[model samples]
Target chain A: MQKHRGIRSTGIPENILGYLMVAPALLCILLIAIYPVFRTFSLSLTDMKMQFPNMAKYIGLDNYISLLQNDRFWSATYNTLFFTVVSVALELVIGFVMALIMNMPFKGRGLVRAAVLVPWAVPTTISATMWKFMYHDQFGVINDILFRMGFIDQYQSWLGSTSSALWCAIIADVWKTAPFMGLLLLAGLQTIPAELYEAATVDGASKVKQFFRVTLPLVMPTMLVALIFRTLDAFRVFDLIFVLTGGGPGNSTETLSMYAYTTLFRNLNFGMGSAIAVLIFIFIFLISLVYIHLLSRQND
Target chain B: MHKSRWSNIIFYVGVVIFIAIIVFPFYWLIITSFKPPEQLWDIPPTWWPSRFYLGSYIAAFTERPFLTYLKNSIIVATSTTAFAVFVTSFAGYALARLHFKGKNAILALALSVSMFPGIAIVSPLFLMMKEWNLLNSYIGLILTYTTITIPLSMWNLTTFFRTIPADLEEAAKVDGASPFYTFIRIILPLAAPGIFTTAILVFIAAWNEFLFALTFNTEDALRTVPVGIAMFPGQYTLPWGDISAASVVVVLPLIIMVLLFQQRIVSGLTAGAVKG
Candidate 1:
């Protein structure tokens, strides 16, 4: 399955031509990806504001030190981690179940499959705004329904209280994204041969036993891939929090990305913001490195 | 024992609730959008429209540059998608199929950039725009957005390219056609579906992109729909009717696009999610 890429062709002229043809792509990455990243590293040193003298004094490590001590930084980190872990755990379990349901031979499967994607298809900001309305204190639909059902007598401001804000945001995210997880898991599920399930059933393997022995092992790698993608996405979350609570009823829902954005543009403290950015970058890089090692091991 | 009837009943109950969680918000938005101004705060809000009115939509545009903003969003989204799909395809094909040296390294680097957090570099990016005199320009917004989405588009496009058999390209090469010629005439025709898929995916991403739209565009005129619509209820006394109307207009086009390309979108989700 591995396509070896150690220079297969012999002719020098055509090889050079091939290289020329691919220059635009290399240019895009150089101009877009590599350049912005370098700029990010550079901008971290500046105490730039929104106004003139965009470059501030290069207070090298002071910004980094200040961020390390900031109380808000610790709180944001906890919220980010909480948001990432709980939503992902919930998504994985529910998504796994949804994927399993879709995998079954059911009537109206095609219609149901498309219906599952309604949330994922909607734009993030749009969906967040919509959910915020539903979470509105006075007349939001969620409060109304819960009130009628005797779940909570007082109107639950889902995005207002510190206790509930982050989870409320995650509920919106999970609603919007779980279908995506289901779709991905379903794809992974399809690749699994039905014959494997057949072989297990014939071997007198209990359904639960078969799942543990056969399904879990085969799907773990794919599931982990999904896990890493979702985890990284959850870690850098911004737009939803911004729209839902504007980082809160007093910074209750403020995420690291929102914090970084606030420090950079809103507050115009590029040095501190960039330091925060750098921290996030390092954290993400370390996480990916671990996952890459795990993934490659599985590949081997 | 096989699954009990009670378990099946419970599963259906769970399924109905899950479907409600997904559907109600949008349904409420649609219903709210159609209601008249007096009904905005009606007690015990109706699930369906009380009466259809076009006034909110009219008010939405009258209050702001709805058409211009929509056009600007279309221009930015369309151009970014076109550039991304065009550039990434050539590169993706080369990386996926060409037996070039250091392809692995290039692929790895590309993948790494894809994972780079958007928030990590957006500030620096803002500074870059200011330096370049790109303040409130469509081109600037497009350029920055193109960067944010390149990794995603490239990965998907490359994978789509990789799925194509090399012999297809080679067959034309063997027939005395040049590689570029074969690519344009032979490979591209067959890759039309992939191309379409990439464009739609990239377009939706760029269209839905709020960070750059919010960060890069300071002028009211330069704003895209997401940033534009976010500003609808901006002032203290926001006209609720207009906000709902604008929301409907902004989101409807996207929903329509998805429905039109329903097949491709589904497959795209499958590839993106399943392959991870």
Candidate 2:
């Protein structure tokens, strides 16, 4: 099943047939992915703004240079990287633990798996809003629970302060996305054979030892895949941050995407926004290259 | 045996906490939607609503164009699903069945495309849409959604199509069936389950899409449920009740679907992830 079953052709060669079949989708991808990227690159080189679309001039790398010197841009870069690193690291740990538990033989395993996916299934904005409600200073559920247990003297406004706003955003993000990591890792877990564990057990290996030696090696590729997906997604965090804090209290939670969005839409600064957009793409590209390098090396 | 019993108890406890972390927000959202305004801000909170209140849901419909938003979301999402299915099916089949010159190249290209930061294209897409007079149009949004979904759906479908044994298609070929005829009659029917699963996946993705929907369709009449909810007007102060009600309306169906099709979604999502 690694290769698709090829049929015996009578008239047309397989190459031509393949081209004909793939043409529509390839065209759509070109229009959808490649064209916009090329367009963005061109747009980045100009002084384009929505209000004065006709007054645009070719500004060679000015937007990029200016963005480099801007403190706000640096903060967004730092914030995005921070969110990506912290949330992804936490998600990997939590998701791995959840995956291990889900892989355990038990009653109601199916139900439990479904329960774990609920958070991922909910829309991001909705999840953010749900957390916002729970983090409400005056009547939030989290505040109520913490206060009742004597953990706090009184309720606190979680999203209103600069210090805690980004972290709160991260917590909400981790809650919504950790299940996605769990699901991907669980898929990896299921693919490892039970016989490996049996063999380890026959050799008198402890469960912990077997996990390190047998399970980890077998599932590393799938884990890498999950890591790459989650990292890329975390780097582009938008809806949750927007709905939760709106880059808030004072630019603390402003991700690259949020900054680009505000520049493009709110400020109507298309040229600078495209430059930020390009920078974000370069960051993603570099990150993917690093992971793919790990991927290729793993093949050895 | 005694140790195993202790491990089992620990495992169940772990599962309970996992479920709690994931599901509590949804529970809170539902409760908040039904709580009367007075109980909403109660210190220590009324753990449960005294009565199920429909006031917020009523307000959601009356004060905002909530129902219209639902209609708009359905239109764009369904259209995107249909377009995705039509294109990805043929592309998946080609990648799976026929030996092509750039087969590996196309697969790798699709994988890289999946990693693209969508916001990178937002500015360009906005300008392009405006130039084409497509801003605020459903067709414009549908086109964008279709592009966003193509890479993953194609990868998923290609994986799925590979699972169909070659012998069945060869048998159809032996019966003098044209290749197109064989695909139409044999492969398409067998691929129904995969197509349905992919369609559901794409539909959900498009439904939850916020960035494009927010920017492209700025008109009040064309807003999707998510943007509609996020951009719902607040007067004087924040409208928590109405917002919660809209969140419930948007999320409840997805939660129900995930529960009903848990196995399908989990497998489809994992397949898309690992293979991509």
Candidate 3:
């Protein structure tokens, strides 16, 4: 194997063969994923509108300049950031607890795990719809349960109120994703050797102490990765919020992606929409950078 | 002993609560799908449906053109899975087994592409599809879906392909078998489980995809499940019953897949994260 590692018997050098093999997949990604990003960036630079394609001209960041002054854009940014932080935080805590439980040697663990994945398996849009129904003010199950339990005198408008709309979306998101987060954390938990716990126990470390000292530190990498995955996902959230609230009750639930969608498709202001798209990309890129840095630092 | 017993009781309670929270929404969805419209909007919503009413399911198909949506979803998801798996298998093989410069760079690029927001590119893709007259077509959605699906498939297959020992290929080479021949005959068979897992994950992603489907396809016949359910008529008065029925139809297959291959899905999903 070492002898033939440098060059294959077929005389197509390994490096050249590698390029040949990856070409098709690379082409697809470049054209579809990479090229469109560049196109969006370039489009953001021009004053393009779907309504007047012939009148399109170079605008040189005017869209972005105006976007900086746009109150709606700022609100959307705040909403996206708020959603990403709160949902990811809740998911992490809930998912960590769920992971610890699933990691236990319990009967019916398989069944429980499968049940937990039910939310993850459901489509996001469906989840949004289901939660929307549950959060309905008058006839919603949430209201019924709360009212029946004497938690509230009357059913409250969850999605209809600006104060609660984003929270409702957040709750729905955490419900759909906490299981997935738990699954990821469970994988990390499994990677910890059994002997580590045994040794900690021998040292007379209590459960809480051992968790803080051993499991928490060891699972940090997985947690960070899962965090970034959910963070970016939450930042780009569209379908759930779109379906659930439509960014309603005075645009309280509007996200950057929703703003971009409304601009590009609904208003047909291609230039402004492209600018929002570019901004979304930049924000996501910064997030990836920070996490990658943290990840690498952790590894070292 | 008393303390441990109390802890055990608490643990069981925790487990029960966890299961209930995760499973209740799904149970409600199924229950609502069977309830009559009046029951659906009752002052105190019925905990359980009085009878199995098939009206919602009947309406979902008969009234909303759900069959066409299901058909389109299947075609787009299946094509995306096949094309992504086929293309990425070779890339994965090369990354895993072959000596190559720029392999890490390519992997990084793929990873970043996976993170790229679908919303960011939807407009340009819409325009591109328009120019090619590919909008509202299966091919357009499939091609776009591949871009999102390929990265994960590549990473997963690469990770899986690396688990396979090179000795099999070495022996094949000693027998004068070509590299391509070894990959096709030996590596692929050994990597079948990994490939299958990747295929399932890709299919689910493509199946659940909403943004591109919403943007590129306006025609009802071309709408995927997510889009169809999202764009359901009766905007003023939402059709919770029909929507729930459609959601059940769409989610049932996914539930079955997760139940049957829970282990494989876990491994595939965590491949990049845990390993990296």
C-alpha lDDT score of every prediction, in listed order: 0.78, 0.88, 0.91
Interface RMSD of 2: 3.2
lDDT (Cα, tens digit) per residue for candidate 1, span A1-300: 111121223334555655665677667667766777777777676665566554477766777777789999988888888898899999999889888888877555666677777677666877888888888777578888888899997887777788998889999989888877887787788889989989999999999998899888788777878888888988998889888887877777888898998887788777778778888898888888888788778778
What is the total number of backbone clashes in candidate 2?
Answer: 0
- Comparing 1 and 2 on DockQ, the stronger one: 2
Task: List residue ranges in candidate 3 displaced over 4 A.
Answer: A1-11
Over the stretch B1-276, how does candidate 3's per-residue lDDT look in tens digits? 999999989999989988888888888999999998888888878889988889999999998899999999989999999999999999999999999899999999999999999988988999899989999899999999988898999999999999998889998978766687789878999999999999999998998898999999999888999999988848588888998899998888889989998889888898777876
Say which prediction, candidate 1 or candidate 3, comes out ahead on DockQ.
3
Ranking of all candidate structures by their DockQ, best first: 3, 2, 1
Give the clash count for model 3: 0
Give all TM-scores, in the order shown: 0.93, 0.96, 0.97
Instruction: Tell me, by TM-score, which candidate is best.
Output: 3
Prediction-by-prediction clash tally:
0, 0, 0
lDDT of 3 by residue, A55-113 (tens): 88998989999999999999999999999999999999999999999999987899988
Give the Cα-based TM-score of candidate 2 against the true structure.
0.96
Question: Could you tell me which 10 consecutive residues in candidate 2 chain A have the lowest summed lDDT?
Answer: A1-10
Interface RMSD of 3: 2.5
Give each candidate's fraction of reference contacts reproduced.
0.45, 0.74, 0.75
Best by lDDT: 3
- Evaluated on CA atoms against the true complex, candidate 2 attains a DockQ of 0.60
Give DockQ per model, in order. Answer: 0.46, 0.60, 0.65
